[model samples]
Target: MLEKEYDVIIIGAGVAGCVAALKLVANGKRVLLVEKLKKIGSHNSRKLDVTESQGIADITAELNLPFNGKFNRSIWYSPNANFELDSRVYDYYVLRGSDVDSFESIVSNRIKSFGGTVLTNAEITNYNFENEYVKSVVINYNNRHQVVNCKYLFFADGHHSKSLEIFGIKERPGPTFIGYGEICVNSELKAGVTHVFFDSKLAPGGYFYLGKADNGEVLSSIVINKALQGNISIKTYYQNFIAANANILKLLGKYKVKNSFVGMGKTGIISRRSLRNMALLGDAGRTMDPIFGYGVRQAIISGYMAAVSAIDCLNNKKRDLDEYEDKLNKSVFQGRETENQKFRNFIDHLNNEELDYAFKSIETIGLSTSLDDFFDNPFNNIGMLLNVTLKKPKLLTTVIIKFFLA
Candidate 1:
């Protein structure tokens, strides 16, 4: 028998895990949140001064939670043009880069305030199963092994989750190497504008980004995609990019070094979302946009959805948890996961010259604007897609065929 039991057990106290805990408690369920790290939300992504997408705002309104995250106005600097996002798209705010650490702290405290249990430095080493359904989690806490039973389990442990394997789900595939690091600049960028650089030379398949906090601290980073055949190492790319990119160097006239890191992740979306009573959320589920690795909003959405599914399953309100995947595909992805996949495939087929040409065409056609402005009604702008197809008929056809075949 297990030492303790709860209505639900959520692993990984990141954004998704915390949201699941808080929401589950609000629905009158006992929740235990487990984090393997000593601290919550202290991951490498936090150090990058990233912005929260508009989906986060929707989650806040839906949940009526007191938590408010500050997001920043952003600018996309392509090889051919530079433009800022139009704020009129939705009620989005820019994240003051300095608030990364505090945001995690606030979420952690909110979970506790709502009577949700959170355990740091606690890891789920294994699980106890009954008839193929996970009945409880075997956790290692503070050097002691503990058995904690629960009706449902949430695996939000991120991109490299072992629980996914335990659940018999095949792993997703992606880039071979991802390198990210912070650089301080003497000069200040736009106060609220986050800048993204998309030149292949700088990051090849990935991109580079920079954002400044209200306090004037800037965090610059480079993510290298598919670094297997690269001549230079990931670190070399980072160092060379800083040294070679004049604009970036000029921006960093004088600055102090803070921290840097490199990691790998699977870029493909997960095929299996759940096995019996166990469900995957966030990176563990591979819900990122793939094109850009933007998952904060997706993470929040997955957590909220998973919590609802868990509650419904435990209460017999739903026959099974299969609805969780269906709901996510319909609601969060808006039935456009295939389109996004096609976009990724199309991008993969392009060379540097083609990429530059595409960006140039976007600027020439007056389509260049804030990221939000374009994505606000992306598909509605069929003219843009048609225009691109007209420019590169062969590539567009291949992308479409691949999507259809898949």
Candidate 2:
């Protein structure tokens, strides 16, 4: 058995944990980052194929850091509209499965360069908390037991976070959905644009996306109503999906499935209060707008914000966790709440009549934008709709009174 102490201890080594460790160590605080997986980012079900750079643009701007790399903008589909999305707006750079090894290497190298310690395959068994504050954590790594004491603990352990449960934190329910995806090489599809197919028959309560990787592989996923109910396996879903979409089937002619991934179970809007001595980031804190399925970007941002708060608390000699909570609420949760309500309203009201009206309105409006554009700037999209209504008052009244009215 071994014992150690640090200024901060972070659990989980996904992108969130890595970003937290980077922030803390860069601020000159000693950090011990532990991951239960054999390697950092191994458990991440989301492949590092596209939108890596565009995912972090906002944070890069805020921090005045250079994160520019090659990422391609793609289209996103909504039942109401098709949008052309620019990756820069989100700070994520798209890469292929072949690029994942290099990307992980770069992240690992960055951590070491910033003077941080990373221990993999270390599973946390229990935590010692006193007076609502975490004092230490017991971990078993490589057949050895150890205890790590720290002033602050950040849980980036993700949705099924055992740490948050142990700490007696309850997750608030919101919009939830489930789905799966895969990577297929030698695909006949072009390697760039993202194609989203929305049909209740295929995915039920969710949507499907087919993103082309840089290496001529297709990265696809389907979002469904909760994880367990989506009994359909990835293989079955993909085969059926290809059969249903004529365009997709034509593009995927004579393609072989190289690598496949499945993510089942409910993923939805969940928010938890960031507590004292302990803070949750990534999926452990809250999920992104499930409708958009941008959880990875949200995780990275939350992790960075959590680290900043932790550093402030440690440096200011304040035990109050309110500051961290305030930052989180003001930044991530507030926007999420609004979006959640709006999407819920939209989904609930979507029927054949509403869809017809929306499609006609979009066509008459003659808006020269894709679904990705609408999703990237929802407020602007709403404004556009309002402008259209102002010009065609009857259309606006019919949409609101017929669809929105109870």
Candidate 3:
């Protein structure tokens, strides 16, 4: 029914696509950002009521693109134990059931401020490529089919992205999980701290988080491992979780469930390359390190990097997209691979004895040990484990040394 052409066509108007459009537009390129949904940020974007603190604030600040918003500090809790981290590490926690329109409005305003056009309710049916380069895309919007040509295409369409499949990209298998969350208003809980309850019974290999949003609403979520192969409903899981964790239920006693969100996907380590003319960003690029499950920051960073690489290729008139590979290697690939391997190993060998010893080590050495120092550098963790094993031989010997030591 309609046809148009632009310098770039971005599929999926979530954070990654929006960020890419913003960067591309800032670079003086005309972009056609399309979304299959009726509105932007309706999928995983809507599911997020709170943004977790990532190392991005510093990185973005360095790039002179600091997010213009207020952040509230919060806590993180381990699901399997009573361990509670009282650190102010997170940047902000969104309240449950916050206004999706308001969030989209902010993002839309930012995109417009950067001179980008957003197209919602536009579902891309397929892509047209020639000589290993993207040429155009066939789309359906409002009961009509159309084709839009573009010089470049960027896919940020979440985990099971349809765009990637059209471009001949496949995702590697990895661990997965099913998760659900809700936002409650007018609760008795404090307005700043996030509470996590680690209950294996309710979440299995996953955990739950309860936090106060910037607007003083409560957001709670339950993440469960899909590897367990159970047919338990999210509603049932929430009920069981509430029954076990009285403190959370008590705080949320009178608050109505304003919004319920559910997501089912692979949450573990999945590997895929993004080097073609049509680049893949965000969850489509890699899915790993669900420990924090902060795909937003990853999406933003990857989108920025992809745009930069694409710009370089265009300016240099180089058909080879090797720089994108290098950027991903440095920023995502290697780090993600290592993190995923480490997590898999850790989870495989984790048991009561090992956990007890690890906790004891934490108690003795304190939490000052940097995450990098312990995980990245194998020798540091080995030394700590050796110390614990020597003192508590009974507890340490039962654990797998190779798993944690590496």
Most accurate candidate by TM-score: 3
Clashing pairs in 1: 71-93, 71-94, 71-95, 72-94, 72-95, 84-370, 85-370, 174-267, 186-254
- Candidate 2: worst 10 consecutive residues by lDDT? 90-99
Q: Candidate 1 residues 287-327, lDDT tens each?
A: 77666664366777889888888888878855357868877
TM-score comparison, 2 vs 3, better candidate: 3
The total number of steric clashes, by the backbone 3 Å criterion, in model 3 comes to 6
Predicted structure 1: lDDT: 0.67
- lDDT of each candidate versus the true structure: 0.67, 0.63, 0.63
Off by over 4 Å in 3: 1-3, 44-46, 49-55, 58-81, 84-89, 94-104, 250-254, 267-272, 335-342, 348-357, 367-385, 389-391, 401-406
What TM-score quantifies how close candidate 3 is to the native fold?
0.83
Give the per-residue lDDT of model 3 (tens digit) for 1-406: 2337877788877666766777777788777788887766666434444454454565455434433234444333333334334444455432211244344445555676776777778888877878878788888878888888887788878777765556555554556767787867787777655665555466666667776665655667787667653787877887788887677787666787667788765543334445467777777766335554533566667777777877887787765556766776676555666566566545534554455455556544445455434544657677765764578766655555646674
| 157-247 per-residue lDDT for model 2 (tens digits) | 8777875566566555655555566766777776545676655455555667776644465666676555323567655665676677676
Instruction: Give the range where candidate 3 is weakest over 10 consecutive residues by summed lDDT.
Output: 93-102
Model 3 deviation from the true structure expressed as Cα RMSD, one decimal place: 3.8
**Which parts of model 1 are misplaced by more than 4 Å?**
1-3, 49-52, 62-74, 80-100, 183-187, 227-231, 315-319, 367-406
RMSD of each: 4.3, 4.5, 3.8
